[model samples]
Structure formats: C-alpha cells, structure tokens
Target: MLSKNLLSEIKEKSDLLNSLKPLSPENQAKLDKKFRLEFNFNSNHLEGNTLTYGETELLLIFDQTEGTHDYREYQEMQAHDVALRMIQEEAAETERPLLENFIRDLNAKILVKPFWKDAITADGQDTRKQIIPGEYKKTPNSVRLSNGEIFSYSAPGDVQKEMAELVAWFNENNGTEDPVLLAALLHYRFVRIHPFDDGNGRTARLLMNYVFAKNNLPLVIIKSAAKKDYLAALNRADTGDLSTFVEYIGNQLLWSLDLSIKAAKGEDIDEDDDLDKELELLKQELNQVPNEFEQEKTYSDVANVMENSIIPLFLELNSKIDKIKDLFVKAECNIQISHVKPNGYHDQLFFTSDDFLFGSSFKAYEIQAAIINFNCTALKKTIRHKDINYTLQIDFDGYNYRISNKFKNEELIILPYKTFLSKHNIDSIVKVVVSYVIDEIKSATNLNI
Candidate 1:
C-alpha cells in the first residue's frame, strides 16, 4: 500500500515540474543529453545489453568506447539512440497523433538489422527462431514464470487487432487522463500486448515516455539497479494489481521531474551525491573484466560491415525516397536532406533533395543521413471528413507525422516490406517510409469522399 502522503508529495512535485515546462534551448540540450545517456544506459542495462553505463556514456557522448563488447551490442545501442531521437524528433517536430508505423519504426530502430536468436519455447523446450524487426510477432510470445507456466501475450493472430484497440483507447482517453497514469497504463498495456518478440520492454518504456513527451511531461527512466523492484512492479500489474506499478512509475517519473526542475533553475546537474564516484567505479569494473568474448574485429572490420551492410541499405532507401521527389515536384514541395557536420547540426542530418521541408543544408560527411523534409505547400491539399473541410499537414506532431488535414489525421496506409533479408536490404524499409508519405498524400485527396 502506497502512503497517501507520498502520493500527495509526488503530485506536488509534478505540479512544480509542470510549472517549469519549456526549459530553455541551451538548458534543454544539456538535460536532454544527460537524460538520454542515463536513460539509454539504464534501459539497455536492464535488458542485459553488456555495455556498462560508463561505456554507454563514452560511446554516446564521445562516440567511442573504452572497452570492447559484442558488435551487435554496439550496433543496437546506436540504433536505440537513433530510435530515441526518432521519438523525440517526431514528438517535437509536430502535433500529429501517434501512428502504428512510428511504433514499428521504433521497434526496427531497436534492432537496426535483424537476425535469428536461439530461444526457449513455451513448454520449456529450446529452439532457434528468427527475430524480425519493424513487425508484430509471427510466433507465440510469452514469459516463463518460476513455476514453469507461461504468461502469454496476445497470440500472433490477435496482435494487430489488439494493438489497434490499444491505440484507439489511448487516442480517446490519453489527454483526459493524468500524464503519469496514462504513461503507466500505456506501459502496462503494451507489456501485456507484448506486440514484438524482443525489445518489448525497451519499446514499452519508449512508448510510455513518448506519451509523456506528448503531454509535455518529464520522461521517466527506470534505474537498472531497480530491476528487481521493476520486474516485481510489472508482475503486480500483470496480475491485475495496477496501483503498485503506477506508484512505482510515478516515483521514477518524480525523479525525472526533479532533475528537470533542477536544470530549469540552472543548478549544476552534472554531479549529485556519488554519481561521479559510481560512474568511475563502474568504469573501473568494466576495465577489470577480461575481454574473453572479444571478437577480432577492427575499425576496418567494422567499416567493412557498415560498407557491405548499412551503406547499401541507406543507398536503397535513398533511391526509393528519391524516386518520390518528382511526384512532389508537381506539388512544388521542397524536399532536401539537411547535411551538416556533427557540431553544426540543424533539425535533421539527412538532406538529399531540394524542397524537403523542415530540412536545411550544411556539409560534413557526403554520404551521411540527410533530412527528408517536405515544405513549401507539400501539405496544401484539402480534404473533406465528416462534412468539414481540412488542409493536409505533414509535419511531425508530437507523436507521429500524419496527415493533419482535418481535426483528426486520416490513416496513412503503408504496405509492409514484402520480404525479409538479413543483409540490411533497404528496399523494404524505404518502401514503408515512402509508402507512408504517399499514403499521406493519397489520404488527403478528396477523391474518396
């Protein structure tokens, strides 16, 4: 049972946090980087991502790690950063409501390039299975309890229907509910849905915070050290006991709120208590651990992997996106990837075509990600929904970029990538992205109406 006084204190702290919304851009960047590192480290650590917090810090902040680990670990961590940024950018970029594709994109970002994983079956049998990113589970997914029984989620056939219901429920009740409550509910519900095979927990947390971001609420990052308690809270929520889990999430959120408040006040947030000491100790621990599982991969080896794997994927995506430029040319939309060095960053890094709205130009790596912006009357089309005329808008609305032509954005139907390829085939990904944009354009047309 949570103390009423404690709950009241949380509410008070949250109110104080609400009063401090819109942290200045400079302070926002500082706190954003800090929270991004801490949250990414803790979230991944909870999922058994082998990198230590110090290592995560080194990689994210300095773009290098002090020690070596699995290449997948590095790749996935970077992918997570990208996904986190995607959620943040999508949230900050516009006021569109959440979309299913954004969630799938985030899932894909969790595991940048998917592969197979050996696993345990529901009957306690061992087997091998492929893990597909950016899609719902195709096989049965459940948790094994200590008693050897299974805690099953939505069956493969029911995932889509249930997820649709979940989204509809959220869309209906989200803004009306308390932000913390809504976040906790979203987290618990997603866990129950267990939509994806792996990275469900991480993805759930991301979606939870994505809700918080939508509400202008401080995002919570559960501490890895609190894993035992965290799982216990989740279990409680699983068993129809929700208050405890809500309280747990509330406490975590309160901590984040306090941090934001501190940053808003211009207080030095770099060091508090033994954080510095703890990080140093963590670094020392990482250093002492033998690299027994180390691979013989070098920078050249990584570069080769990127060249053979990631670059081709990017190229394919670029090709698919570029093909759509001419279609938009008739609409007079500016589509360009904003290219810039790491330091002179703008809204987005990718700038491939001219007239990509929300993308500007600068130069750094010639082949790096460029912003895919659509501006200058890209969203000028009007549509009729429920007898009300609306103009289509394709900017990121806190949750997902959708066609905001009417009061509610119409569905942007995108076909799934037809085939799965392990070599990071960009065709499917680029297809989904471009298809979404195309659907946005199609949905805004008055033809059907």
Candidate 2:
C-alpha cells in the first residue's frame, strides 16, 4: 500500500503528462529512443549483460554492433528489444487480459533460446544445467548472495499455481489501484515467485512496465549503475519491509515522470552520463585496431609454457597427491613427453625421455633440442602407487589443447594460449587427477568413503 501523499504526487504528474495530449513527432521519437535505451540497456545490464550504453545504442538503434561480446549477449539484447515493443503493443490493447502464457512468451523472447550454464549444487559441486527458456524449472534453483549465503526461490512445483494467483491478483485490482503502486507491487510479487529459471529479474521488470504502459504512465527504468540500491530494496522487501522497496521504485518512477515531462515540453532529455558513455565507446573503438604483424611462436614460448604451465601443474599435483601418499605402499610421480614414431605400431604411444622432467627449468636451447629430438605428441604426468596408475595429460595438436585424465577431459580452445592454462583450468585438471587416484585406491582397497 502506498502513502496518500505519494499517490497524490503520482496522480499530479500523471495528470500533467496527460494534459500534453500527443507529443510532436520529434519529441515522440526522442522519448521513444530514451525509453528504449534506458529500459533495454539497464534491464539486461542488471542481469550482467556486458554491453555499454553506446554499444547497446549502436546495436538497437543503428543495427550495428561494435564490441567483442558473446554472440548470445547481442542476440538477447535484440530479443529484449523485440519483447519491449511487444509489451507496448499488448498494453495498448485494453481488452486483452494478462496471461501466464504471455509472461512465459516474454521470458522465452528475452532469453532467445535454450542453453547450458555452469552451476554449483547445494553440496558445492560443479555441474551443468540446461536452461529451457519460457518454461518453469524442472529442478530446484538457488543463488549465492554477496554474503555467501544461499537464497533459494519458490520451488518449481509451486510456480504454476503461484503465477496463476499472481496474475489473478493483478488483473483483479488493475484499474482500481494507483498505476505506479500497482506496477511496483506487481514487480515485487513476480520476482518473489521467480517463475522462470533464468531471466526472472528481466521478466519482472518487463511485467512491471506493462502495468505502467497500460495505465499510460511513463515506464520506470531500474538503472544498472544503481544495482546495489535496487537489490537492497528487494532484499528489504524480502524481510517484510515492502514499502521501502515501494518507495525506492516510486522514486525511479519519478525519474521517468520527470523525463517524460521534459520530453513533452520539448526540452533536452539527454542524461548527465551520456557524455561519459560516449567517451567510453570512443576509447573502446580506438583500442580495437589490430597490430600490423603477428608474432611467431618460438622456443622461448615453449620455455615460458614449461615455466608458467607445466612446472606449476606438476607442483600442484604433487602438493595434492602428497596428502594421500601414506595410503599407498610406494608412490612415484614422473613427467613424460610423447615421442611419435612415424609408420610404427606404437606411433600413438607416449614414451618418456631423459630430456623431459618436471620441476627442472629448461633453457630455450634445451626446449629447442627436446622438440627437435622428440616428435612431441603430448605432455603427461603419471602417478604410480603400488599396482594402480593415474595420468593427467595435455594433448595439443596445433588446433586444440585437450586436458584429459581418467575421470574427465576438457578442451580449452576458445581462451588465448597464454591464458588457456589459468588457475581455474589447473584446478579443474588437479581435481580430476586427485579424484582418479582416490577412486583407484578405493577400488583396490575396497574402502567405503
């Protein structure tokens, strides 16, 4: 419920905007552009879309994207724009009722398509989950907050029932309540439910604006720059302080109202941060020019690889496996580099040479000599404990770097060569390496974990 003074304030602004009949063509275009950019850029940015305001404007208005963003990010921005226009059209049809399918369609539209995302389970295990856009989640979902606490949303089982109830509540009180208040409450309620797996926040904002559009009010923009405040308000609402969030939302509506009045009065409606956004885009464009010549890979590059990637990798494995060394009768760790034999039966087999060893620094000449003497097929680390053996290997063939062990293998191809063997990458390899050794021990010893 809104305070009487706030309601009166909103009514006054609404009345003034209404008195300005139809805005001129120029004013209308300016207002549309402003609203479109504000809504699209902020809404998606709140959900971690990396496009800057200038990039978003370029993509949405000029249909020319100027960034190295993921293709999906660009697609979602365009899809969200389409959904924005769609809701405006829907809002114009007064006879049309808000339906669950319509809301689901908005979710589907903004998300673009189904895809898989990396997720962490409640037990803190890494896993992949498929996002089915426009549909309710099939499994449970939760988020880890800034404070490192897990916040779970409404369970998947209750989504359909709660959503139906939400829509009914909104439609029942649609025209009677103050439009801004209604929009605010509608946004909060929809977010509380979190109906869709992904895009719930984006969808909630869209739905909130739907109420404003239907009531002929200026749609509020939740600026991404103020995400902390926005989320803080939502957090307060979670603790039964709904009015705090309502007030926060009301203030955002005031901004939209103020901008609308300016646009209606044919005044300059450009934001204060517009110049900053332009300069940022200018800098990004200036930095995107390519160097004239490409650097060739040399022996020093291999030596750097040995120092930065291979040596650290072996030490990391040694540190982890050293913890369980007591369980084995005897544990030995060795570095093995593959030497491929042309037109031989064991061509693919990796054989160890005295030249390649872990923890030993190799000079540029030494790396050159090793590569020249041995037809290097792969680099491998093998841990032998009693009769059990475990291996972690990197198989690179000029095109892809594939890290494989007994448990799992991952291809680190998209990342740059220098950064392909990152800490996270090494951790993943180490995890599987440790898990493989543990599993082998368990199998041989028949020990219950």
Candidate 3:
C-alpha cells in the first residue's frame, strides 16, 4: 500500500547504495562500529536505558563502564548487543527458514533471563509478574497512551495463533514483497501481538532489521530522539493506515542509505552532535568527585571477597554435591582459580586440595574469578547418558561481580561491590547450583527423585 512516489524513492536509494558495492575494509569496519554503537544506544535508550551514548561506547567497545545506574541496565545493554550479532549471523544463512523458535531465542537473548516485573492488572491493581524469556506471555499486557487511555495488545490466549499467522505471512511474502515494507509490516505485526511479557519493543526492532539484513539492505535505526514520531506512525497504523508507518520506515531506511553512501565515498559520517556529546561527557567526568569514579574493586578487594565470601560458597556447593555423589557411579568435584598475575597476564590454575587456599602461592597473585566443575560418569545399566558435567563460575568485571554457568555467558546474579556477598548471597548461589545438579541428575538417570 506504499505510494508510488515513496516506493520509487526507496528503490532509487537502494540502487545507489548497491552501486557502491563493497567499501574499503577500514571504512566498512568504521561504519560497522558506528552503527553498532548507534543502534545499541538508541534502541535501549528508547526503552529507558539511562546509559549515555558515550557510556554505551565505553562499555560495549572498551569493556569499561561508568555512571551509577543499576547494574541491570548495563547487563541488558550487553545482552542486546549479543542479540544484534545473533541476527547478523542468522541473516547470513539465506537457506534457513525463519521460525518461531528463532524469534523466541532472540527474545531470550535480549532480555537475558527470566525475572519479575511490576505490572498493572486489568482492574487497575498494581502487581508483579514473572517474565520468562523466549516464551509467549501467560498474562495479558497493555500500555497507557499519551491521552491516558489503556491500549491493549492481543490477548494471551490468542497470541500463539496470531504469531503463527504472522510468521507464515512474513515467510510467504518475504522475497516478493519490498524489503522495506516487509520490515515495517513485520515490526507492526509483532508489536500488535506483543508476544513476550517484556522486551517486545526491542525484539520487534531486531526482527525488522533481520529482514533488512537478509535482503542485504542498510539497517534502519529508529532514533531514540525521534521516538515520538515513531510511535505516532504506529498509532496511525493502528487506525488502518499502514502505509504511513511504511513511509516512516522508508524514510529511516533512506537515512541509513545516506550514511552508508557517505561511508562508501570516504566522507565523514559522524554528526556534529557526536562531538558535542563527547565534550559534555568529558565535562561531566571532570566535575565528578574522585570517590564517585572509584566504583570498581581493587585487587586487594577482590582477594578479600574470594577469601571471605567465595571460598565459603564453594565449600558449601561441594558439600551439597557430595551428598548426591552416591547416585552416580563416578562423581567428582574440582576447583580452578582464575586471576591476573603481576605481569598483567590472565591465567587459570588448577587446584586439587580442599584446603587449596592454605598455600602461600595463592596470595601472590590478584584473584579475579573462580570456577567449579562437577563431573560424573553414569553407571552402566543404571543410567542412559554416559557422562554429565556441570560448571559454576563466579567472576568480577571491573564494575560488578557475577555468578553464572561456564557453558553460558548469561549471569545468574549480578552483585555490586558495596553488597559484596552476604549469607543471603551464599544461599542463593548454592540453591541455583544444587537445583541445576538435581535437574541434570534426573535427566541423566531418569529418576523421579
């Protein structure tokens, strides 16, 4: 339903960008970095991430984070970057069909993990609901409009059916339809469905770009500054005028094309505002007190936490695993220490003894993280699976400490330096580890217990 004029404009821009073909490696890399930062910063900012553009660049590119925002904000930004890379890789597989599970995985990657969120019930009562990543909503969701009216999405019971139809329509018209229009429609339909409890907006944007990437078109960004216009276009689409939203997306695509074409011609693509923003950030950094910037724990602090908190947690985990060891033919637990040496090198050294900390050599280096691996060999004729291995990892980034499994980069819990680790922390860590072990045992041994 796009007007001929708009469609022609989009075609012209697309052709112009295509004519440039491959850009220089250096130029392409610069463009990629620019878009990565811009996309991550703007998309999350639209959804209320408090990290500034400069802070986003530092965190994503340099692994250096600043500001005093909740650690969850930082974690979500990183997770969104992961989801971006995932779509890029996924788009490259031209032969593979896009499926519901892939979309679910994308949602999971963006949200990072299941957690509870505050919500308002239909009767206007405030409540909290658990958001399970990669799954359709079990509870209904709605939004409040600028006019103070409630705007409801598709009902929870109807979501599965609607989503199946949406995916089918997308796959059916994917190639034949104009990629820009296809991207816009995909975004609109997904938003209408609101399949997940949280992260629906972010997920919708990613899926829209996935369509563009598959078509080898420039990735369109919905600038956070222009969020009002973007929402207005969606509101217009809600009234049955879908073409306006398509035109809005087409215009955004044109912006991307213009930027890409400039990069192709070796022109400066950075806006004047970028420098101004950088200067503002510099001023803020200079005005802050010294203690405000000292958010990260020192090597000595790391040593203290490992000794006082981590060792006890590890011992507790070992004791719990020991109780379940008899269920398998061969079950063993081991510990490995990860730390930075005096030479500024990172190393992971194996430790065999339960009292491994008693050695003087352990205190010689700066400890950063620890790993515990539990390995089990299933009893023949007793268990079907041959071997089961699970790993728990605890590490401190410069700004925060995290506990997670070695196989997955997802953090189970992120703790700040101020809280460090308490008895409550130890209990939470042990609970997760023990639960995972039990689940793995049940799956491997087929025992209900």
Candidate 4:
C-alpha cells in the first residue's frame, strides 16, 4: 500500500504544477514535439492497427531491446509481434473506436491462427500439451488462478460490458476531476477488468497513457523492471483495495509534473514556494466577505466585475493574467462608510455611473439618493427634486436622477433597463454600479443618514 506521506508528496507536486503559468507558443510547440516522440515510442506497435498477444509482446520487446537481440530472443519476440499485428488488422475503423473493439480484434486474430488453435503433440501422439500462447496462459472459461500461476486471460464475451462502462465513465468525467487521479482510477479499473485473451496488461497501460494525453498531461511509462510492483497493485485492486494503485499512479503523476514544471521554469523544480498554504489563506479570506450589499448586488454584478473589471485590470497590470498575486495587491481598495437616518433624508440620491459605494447600511431610498447625487456631479447637471419612491435611475450620459413619486418601486423594475443596457457591454454597468456604491456610502455617512 502507498503510505500517507507519499500521498502528501504527490499533492505538493500537483500544487506545483497548478502554480505554473502557461508556456509561450514557442515552448509549447517544443513540449508537444517531445510528448509526441514519447507517445510514438510507446504506441509504435499498432502501426498496422492490429494487435495480438504475440505482436504486442514483440513490440514490447522491440521497445526494450531495440531489435538487437540474439536468435533465442527473436523466437520469443515473434509470439508478441504476431499477436499484436493480427489484432490491429482485425480491428474495424470507426469514427470513435472503443477499448473492446481493440480487444475483440486481437482475439479474432489470435483465434484463427493454426499454431494457436492446434493441439500440441508429444511422443508422436496427439496428446494435448499446454503451451503459453502469446504472453499469458489460458484457463478454463469458468476457472480462477491460484498463486504463481500465469495471469488468467478472460474471453471477449466476459469483459465487453465492463470495458464499455469504463470507457463511458472516462469520457464523461475526464475534465471534471483532477486529471491525475482520473487517469489512475481508469488505469486501475481497466487492469482489474483484464478483458483480453492476452496482452491485457499492455493494452491497459496504453489506455492509461491515452487518457493522460487527452488531459494534456505527460505520458507515463510502466517499465518492465517495475512490472512486479505494477501487478501487485493490480492484484490489490482486484481485492477491492485501491490505496496501492492510487499511490503507484500518484507517484507517476508527480514525476510527470516535476518534469513539466522543470521544463517550463528552465531549471530544476523548486520547493520553497508554499503555494498550497497561500491558496488556502486566500480562500479563507474570500469566504469571510458577507453576501449582502445595500445597492442590491446580483450574481451578474459579481460575475461582471470579475470577468470584465478584475480580469482586465490584471491583464493591464501584467502582460498576462499569470501574475494574480500582483493583481490582487493592486486591486485592493478602501471601503467607504455611509450612514442614513429617516428624518431629513432625501427620497433619492443622484449619482453618475462612475461612482462606487463601498459600505453602507441604509434603506434602499437612501442608497438611491446617494447614487443620484454622484451621478449629477459627474454629468454636471443640476439636481432636480422629484418624488420617486425607493428607485434610483441613471441615464446613458452617466447622470443619476430620480423619477417622480408616482413611479412605484414595483413598476420601476430592471427588466427594461437590463434589456436596453445589454446592447452595450455589461462592463459599462459594472463601472456604474461601483461608482454608485462608492458615492452612496460617502454621502450617507457625511449627511448622517
């Protein structure tokens, strides 16, 4: 099983990856080329688009030995090569091929081979002798394996449904969860299913790497030297234990993250920055802000500010939005205070679109009055007395004015105003809201209302 300490280390590695900025276009192209090279190295066996146990093993050995082996090695390698090539050729091309299609293709190819189908003979008698076909041994259709026995291969019928479910799950959740964990789960599940007649291990690893590439992560290699530990993890997964598999995959993810981060930084990965702690603190601070705003701030208000105001502000401060830390510091503003009492209070405040009220606890009418005041100042218009009840209205010229008292709060709805304003970019409304709030707070507190 993977220790908790190792899991913590993996989390740190993931945090480091998340902290990285996007690479430059030139660097991105370079990284893509490197990734493709590694991918091709691992996937080159399927050049014929068919696979069988023999062909798969041949490719595995070829990848390991670079085809520089002696006669004995070549004989052993032939089984793997033949198996993989047959499988690839039989697999039907589809717009979106599935894992089962790959396995079924391999199975059909291997089953038709006379060498695989014919019973072995000993002592000139056709006494059936067991032979290891491709890479794995066959068991009775309903039998299970004991310790030290060959890896049991299941027929295509036994695993088709399970494989389909796995692929469906991967497609749906690929982008929703952490990619590293998602890949790990997929890898473990695929290996546990063990759906192919042979070469299931290699195919499972290939699927794992496919998921990694789909998620824009680096490719992971399961070395032959580590095959024992890999099988142990799969065994644990078979027994419904996943801690070991999670750890094994988490370690691979850490390695990928470390390499990618190093390449991006143009140096060895650093450990000094406590990014997780910093992020935690920032989240806590954001959570402390209350939801209520005196000026009726809707969900759209915050979204607008973040997307248009905050994002652009950061973009202007730095060429890219990667320098979020600096942007936060620069965007900080003091909260202006405002107070309002019932007596002697104007029904509405006049303000322009440029005013922003920061903090004020007053009735809606007082808030409206402050907005009117600020709007009149910016528009250079005279303040006209009107009997508008709790509604504050602003014109297109950045002037804030109130309707007559006959205007009812219920009828002074925002739908028409919203529809009219939508023609202009919503950011313009955000600026108006910010300015209105700032002025309202100042006016209410100054006049003790």
Query: What does candidate 2's lDDT look like per residue over 404-440, in tens digits?
Result: 4422332211222243365544664465455555554
The local distance difference test score of each candidate is 0.62, 0.70, 0.78, 0.41
True lDDT of residue 282, candidate 2: 57
Once fitted onto the true fold, the runs of candidate 2 whose alpha carbons sit more than 4 angstroms away are 122-125, 279-449
Ranking by lDDT: 3, 2, 1, 4
Tens-place lDDT per residue, model 3, 367-425, is 87888787777744242546667787878777656667678564555554554555545
- After TM-score superposition, the amount by which residue 100's alpha carbon in candidate 4 deviates from its true location, in angstroms, is 4.2
Q: CA shift at 172, candidate 4, in angstroms?
A: 4.5
TM, every model = 0.60, 0.64, 0.63, 0.38
For every candidate in turn, the CA RMSD to the true structure comes to 22.7, 12.2, 17.4, 28.6
In model 2, residue pairs whose N, Cα or C atoms come closer than 3 Å (at least 3 residues apart or on different chains), thus clashing, are none
Across residues 168-211, which tens digit of lDDT does each residue of candidate 4 receive?
88767756876566777877776666554344555555556655
The 10-residue segment of model 2 with minimum total lDDT is 369-378
Error of 1 at 332 (Å): 72
- Residue 406 displacement in candidate 4 (angstroms): 99
In Å, residue 62's CA in model 2 sits off its true spot by 0.8
Q: For candidate 1, lDDT tens digit of each residue in 334-439? A: 2222234457665433223332234322222322221223332344334222111122222322211222222333322111112112321233234334444554
